[model samples]
Target: MIELRDAAYDYGGGGLALRGLDLSLAPGSFHFLTGPSGAGKTTLLKLLYGELRPTGGAALLFGSDTRAMDRDGVSDARRRIGVVHQDCRFLDHLPVHDNVALPLRVAGGDVASRADDVAQLLGWVGLGARMHARPPELSGGERQRAALARALVMDPDVLIADEPTGNVDWDMSQRLLTLLAELNRMGKAVIVATHDLALIRAAKAQVAARVLRLSGGALSAAGADL
Candidate 1:
């Protein structure tokens, strides 16, 4: 869960990208953050994942204030909160399974021992047969699903996805949302930052989801239209 109270982030000469943004994501909760191109949607996602610290007010990840957390504290909190970035980062030279297992390997877990889990996750995302493929070899949907698999490898408490379905086709977008909804059903707080109202509406039809709009440096509850 993430909580922000009057949180403002200023990028020096770039001026303030976000200001006075008040929001909270509770356990088992699902939210859709919608905004225009220049809005601070991605910035808000980074704040939730501890990539950016607020210049003013509070940004809490779990129960600790992010501004007060040391490197170790931030890293520890990240282990409990999984993130799927918009770009869908991956090591081009690594296979899908190894890429998905990177977090565990970094946390010093026995990656080899969890091979079954990794395979299960890949299959869950409909990528079992492609687990051995490199990032460049997969299709767009496969890449997104692979990223999701990587993000969920830690079995995180909170899942933050930034524009996950932005570049994919409609079918792939729905597939990705279904996966996210299933995770929410499994009790992970989910916040997806996207401008895709159609996908948001589709997700709403499948589960209880809240819509929040981030625009003009403020956050407010949006109607179902979002």
Candidate 2:
């Protein structure tokens, strides 16, 4: 559902993020993006989610060229994709339920009608009792799940998570991975960008994962070990 052809992103002032990167992700496919710091993993994820347009070449989402898409077009395209960032931020004053439902609210949906649905989603991510709590009150893992719940709240066609397991412990990480695996099984394409090889290994054991490593502003299939 996503493709990048000869994509190059220049950060300006002698820095380039991506260079001639050619990548494609099939619908319902599960993949891991791995690389060292500043290797363009996050840049690549931004490209997929329409947060960044390639400086050269084409970056396509579900057949729509990102460079050619207008603001409304980009927003519409992003509605089909969900992203979990490394540092998930939420309004500290808002309750967890409200924070998770912010996207729907921003999209001008009927909040009352979607209240129960958002609550159930919070419960799914193990935040049922914490629904009334503010974001600052949540623990690290709780915040992570809250972010995941928020991402899935849109029921997106494609899920892109950047360093999802970064803040959680091993067991919690496994639980989050399992949840993502289940989503992939349910036919939602998932792309995760992470530096943890162990997490990738764990995920690969549960699903047929296609792993890619970004290096020197380029992307390629990861070797067997990673």
Candidate 3:
């Protein structure tokens, strides 16, 4: 679990990207983070995952203050959290299966022993047939799904997705949402940062999520209008 208590972050000359934020992500919790351009959603996500420690307040991951964590501490905490970045950062030279297996490999996991799990995860994301395709050969939706598969291959306790459905069509967006919802049902905490209101509404029928809005370097609960 992660908790931020009056967390604030400033990027030197970039001014304050986030400030006075308090958030607690417990087991089985689901949250949707929404905001406009330059609103610091990505910065907040980075803080949550321990990529950036808060400059003025506490940002804790798995019970330890991120500011106090060493590199190995950060890596250990990150291994428990899976993040699907906005750009779907994949190595074009690697096939989808290998790309999905990269995290396990980096974590010193037995890739050979988990081959079947990797295949099953790709299939779950609807990319079974495209497992051998390289990143450059995939469609936008396919790439997103593949990214999700990669994020999940580690079986992390939390999943954080940034604009996960931004490049896909409505149907594909729904498909991805359904997959996320299923994961939530299985007890993983889910945090999705998206600007898509319709997608948020659609998620209403599938899972219980607290919608949050970030603006002017602060965070607030979204109104019922969402």
Index of the highest-TM-score prediction: 3
Q: Between 1 and 3, whose TM-score is larger?
A: 3
lDDT of 1 by residue, 43-158 (tens): 98888888999988899998899999999999999999988888898999999999999999999999999999999999999999999999999998899899999999999999
Please name the candidate that would achieve the greatest lDDT relative to the true structure.
3
By lDDT, rank the candidates, best first: 3, 1, 2
Clashing pairs in 1: none
lDDT value for model 1: 0.90
lDDT of 2 by residue, 1-226 (tens): 8888998998999875688888787777998999998888888889988899999999998899999999989897787787888888788889999988988887788888999999999888889999999888888889889999999888888989999889989999998899999999989999999998999988878888999989988888999776
Global Cα RMSD, each model: 1.1, 1.1, 0.9
**Whole-structure CA lDDT of model 3:** 0.94
Query: Candidate 3: where is the Cα deviation over 4 Å?
Result: none
Distance from true location, Cα of 195 in model 1, Å: 0.6
**What order do you get sorting by TM-score, best first?**
3, 1, 2
In TM-score terms, candidate 3 sits at: 0.98
Q: Comparing candidate 2 with candidate 3, which one achieves the higher lDDT?
A: 3
